[model samples]
Target: MSGETPLRVAFIGCGNIATRQHGPAFQTIPGVTIVAGCDLLPERAQAFTARFGGRPYTDLTTMLAAEQPDIVVVCTREDQHVEPTLAALEAGAHVLCEKIMAHTLAGGQAMLMAARRTSRLLGINYNYRFFPPLVTLKRLLTEGALGEIAFLSVTAHAFCFHHALDLLRWLGGEVVALTGQVSVAADPQVHYPVRCPDFVYVPSRAASVVVRFASGALGTLTATRYEHLTTRLLRLEVAGARGRLVVDGLTLDDIVGRLTRWPEGQEIPTGAGPERGFALSFQQADRAFVARVRGAETPAATGEDGYAVLLLERALVLAQTTGRTIALPSLTPVAEVGR
Candidate 1:
């Protein structure tokens, strides 16, 4: 076993996310060897292997037995996450499964159980938690900078599963309960005919969710797909024991501490330098995975962490379905100071 050799990894999915986010970011991180690739689709596996330098395989079991990767990156669709993640854990490989966590509660539980049974690290790619500014804010929260942490307000839309899980995990603070409402608003103007074919229409959702954390902190998450442009608006207000702070346009996070204040109408400090791209957060997450593989660090979002997030997500969906608040399941707690 070449354990110390650049930690070998297999990419289980070769879709758009694997290409645009994970694949490109893997090229930037150190101590990573993307040794094998697999997908149900042979062409996608071949294409990914061609672009990223790996052996392409159609079956993950075969790939695992042959390549013997120390880590597996499961960037597959949310519905397809459980099987591969379970397989990898059973094979004694750590897994980084992309999020929502899974399509359903049962699927997510299976993955969690497999990880626990095998005692292998399982991480869900809740990448937004890695955003530099968010990390800084989390540190401040640990110091009780925000007076009482009265309420948390969030305004954003669907993030293709991966992005949504990150924000929920980061801001909610170990959710104890969830109540959600999903609404659809249709626009006749949204329907437009294509030049060569029939008509194409865009669909949108308006969701309002309320989450209560174990520490009594509350978060109100409102999502609507009616923005003028496709963008994310992440705003946090942590009212501490003495003062309050707000984080906006998180890309300029290096100057995070110098940002806005609470109670409104106060002069906000500005950060220097132009705000860069969102891709940086994804890169940070990939680097964290590599670091964990090398025993340099533990993953920010572990398999149990993934399970917790997925549990909350399931509760939210159930809340939406039954129009009632759902209680969070009991967690096998870990000892992480100031988390």
Candidate 2:
């Protein structure tokens, strides 16, 4: 086979996440070039450019005008995601935006609109779904190995409520009715910059949400603030008519009765190191975004997918506040997005 055409790529933010996850992983993906980078802080941008071999800019418009990259990676803060993403999409650049898609509902909607207005593919960097174990789970569901999914129980213990919300969509189809609550209970185990009542908040920080899927299946989502736990733990259980699948880290075991079944796990242990399982997940996500940018295939975390998760979260929040189950609304699933 012949070599593929190189794709010019720009880094829009030079923050810690951009440095750690995006930068290292982008290098491994083929057909990508770090042609330009932009940051509000010139020093940080310059430092990143020096390390990654890209021209640095303090503003996005300047970078877009100069580089005209095929893809723009938005790794800015949660509050700053929409504007730069919209600007990049409008400039005809495909975007891979960081998670927590946007800070507010309106901001999320605006970003959605911008992607629709332009034909450029927009994707959210939802790294968790790219996990090898999770990927296996999705395939199992699609292959009918899991039978009809009756219920999904997810236990997310950290600042990753979005992942839990996104998983609901990933596994249980669209949500029709949701009732939830976010509570504040004192715990000394976790530390974060964003503060809530009793250092806890609802939906995002710590919450119990019950999602009723359109197919009549039910899912229960719960996230808690553990006082003594330092490591992140995600426990997802999908119980169907046949059996239950429990996966933690690299091990995926199908439990029908007292025995484990099939390819039990990966060779490396789940919490072995920072460079193993989850690291591989991020690398997979980087490649997926790169593939989408190269016109190979749409990423698993498409703009429509991200917006759907946001809409579900918004509905869950309203349900928590109103003391009633909120019904899902009709949404525009057009690939284009704008604000």
Candidate 3:
């Protein structure tokens, strides 16, 4: 928290994300130290600690008790998020959870409640919000560069549907209602690369959702894993009464091929270079979380935001199943939803 004392950080799941993004990003921060890494497999934990400089442990309870970390980064699989997050909060540590908050609404709600009960910050890694071009777009929207957003459309990979949902809420406004449709993989042999067979839930390979925002803005999100090209891993276009903005190409390493404004036919500089790539967004996200933990006012997705996205995911699924529009009350408490 102070310049003299480095914040002791620990990782709960030292798998792919921790190894690639979180570990590397934290290493670049000034006043943070990786104290421990915990994983179900000792070899994985050891491998993570070897590169990131931490003690390795196979048990989370043992690591939490021994290390007493200031912050816990939950990089576990989707279904595994809630348990470690709640545990970390109970152990008196703030948490930075990986996305898709949890596999279910109740799980997300439990994690949210735990954070409130412990009075510790619970930030979700909605890293796309930190993409420089998107950051500028948010600033422009706030300044009313586009007067009153009217419509938004997002195209993303099926794996990024949650990110698309988060973007809709972030760039547009609160969603009031939504309808959705999905195309499930017909072949039993076809499974998403990252999701394990034992995982509680696996998202569809392609899906579409239409939403009505509280600002009266209508939006559509279409996501599919069938696309072989990387040109539009994630693309967002927003239109307002005054003008329109388009941000194309949001991939892991290459992001924002172009950011352009309509009518004026002007190209906007994103101020992001190809060298850093989209991975810089993860660093930005990690830096914001660290700043918040140090008692600074920073913009990062909160537990409530994560819960709201999960709620929308649930609504979308319900809409697809029932073939009906789901109305979400803006004022409703997350805990009270789907009860």
Candidate 4:
């Protein structure tokens, strides 16, 4: 800990996510200490601690109890997310979890309920907005640079639909109703795991959804998993009344640093800056979480936001399975006011 009592950060699952994204990023965030790391396996946590300079443990409860971290990052599989997140939040730690939040709406809401019960911050890793181009796009929309958005078209192949859904919600607004296709796998009993290794992997391996935003603008999202494709594939077309914005790919240089994609005549917003790494976006996320802890700003993505994304994900699957246009549901039984 350094500089006026740093926030102590603990990692619940120090696998690839903790090793790659959250670990290094947390180490660099000002006033944040990489206090402890845990994994179901000792070797994984040990490796994280060895590089990231944290104490390592095998069990989450023991680590949280002994170290009393200020923030817990749940980098476990989606199915494994709720337990550790709930445990840490109940222990009064702010939590940041990898997205698609959870596999089901109830699972996501359970995590939200834990945060609500404890009044701790629960944030999601919806890091797409951290891209400088999209940041600028968000700014343009906010400042009325694009006027009222007309429609959006997106094609993405991600491990899950959460990020794509977040982009749609971010570019447009709340979804009213949607219809499309969702499937776990082309082969029954062969739904492949993308990156997740530890837990039972259950996610739509392919998805296509047509979103009707509450703003009355419409959008289409297509997502699928290419188990063999080495490169990321993403494209966004945002059409507004005044002008149009299109974004391609999701990498540091490919997405944010590539400035040539800026709308025909206008420069990127004067103050829009690149958030260096897609990994670096985790740092930006930590900065926001720390800011929230300091009462200076809000966390990047709230529990409710993550819950809403899950709703859209589940709804999309439901729409395809049931073959009906499904109206979106409230995040909870009723909205959690002022969340």
Candidates' C-alpha lDDT: 0.67, 0.72, 0.84, 0.73
Considering lDDT, where higher is better, how would the candidates rank from best to worst?
3, 4, 2, 1
lDDT of 1 by residue, 1-339 (tens): 434447787899998989888888887666677888899999999999999878999998999999989889998875678788889889999998887566655676677777777878788777767655566666667667675776666665433222443465565577777787766556644322211011001124566678887778777766555643233445555555566666665422232323456565453533323534656667778878777766676335776676666565556567767788887654332222113
Which has the greatest TM-score? 3
Q: Taking the tens digit of each residue's C-alpha lDDT, what string does model 4 give over 123-162?
A: 8888776666677766667787667888888777645345
Estimated TM-score per prediction? 0.81, 0.85, 0.92, 0.87
lDDT of 4: 0.73
Give the Cα error of residue 137 in candidate 3, in Å. 0.8
With a 3 Å backbone cut-off (N, CA, C), the pairs that clash in candidate 3 are none
Candidate 1: stretches off by over 4 Å:
1-5, 160-169, 185-203, 250-258, 263-275, 297-299, 330-339
- Which of the predicted structures, 1 or 2, would earn the higher TM-score when compared with the native? 2
RMSD of each: 6.6, 5.1, 2.8, 3.8
lDDT of 3 by residue, 108-157 (tens): 87888888888999999999888888888888888999898889999887
Better model by lDDT: candidate 2 vs candidate 3: 3
TM-score of 4: 0.87
Candidate 2: regions farther than 4 A off: 185-205, 227-230, 250-277, 330-339
